[model samples]
Target: MQAVPNAFSVLSHPSLDHSGGGRASSEVPRPATLFESAELLKGGKIVGIMHNGSLYRLQATKLGKLILTK
Candidate 1:
């Protein structure tokens, strides 16, 4: 039988530096909640979960178009 690969492993990469004072020249306007979600999606490195009356972000890879659960 073949062994299954671990999913909790994390790989690190070098940081990116932008010379234009951190802001891009062409930026699109977005909703505050959506902008926050996108930032959380990028920086959080995990998926967001909702439980009860509040929302929580968790660490898990997304699979296709299926719904995610914690």
Candidate 2:
């Protein structure tokens, strides 16, 4: 275990010096209506989310609902 450092010790670690002032490049963010685009969805109710060589399926149901499966 390690002891906690004071506020002055915060910058002791290396940093990328992002001009965005600490926004992570790897952070994936999107708007709530991201899948609302007809072109991306291709006029279908399904879309695939690829992660680590795996495909996740997102489907819009006939009841106007959503379902996700791996």
Could you tell me every candidate's TM-score relative to the true structure?
Answer: 0.22, 0.42
Error of 2 at 31 (Å): 7.8
Position 24, candidate 1: lDDT: 35
Clashes of each: 1, 0
Number of the predicted model whose lDDT against the real structure is largest: 2
- Cand. 1 TM to true fold: 0.22
Best candidate, TM-score: 2
Write model 1 residue lDDT over 1-70, tens digit each, in one string: 2322431121111122144454432553232221233444665456766789777655434542323454
Q: Can you tell me which runs of candidate 2 are displaced by over 4 Å?
A: 1-40
Q: Model 1 lDDT vs. the true structure?
A: 0.40
Compose the digit string of candidate 2's lDDT tens values, residues 1-70: 2333442233322254344556434554332222243554677999998989999998878887878899
Can you list the residue pairs that collide in candidate 2?
A: none
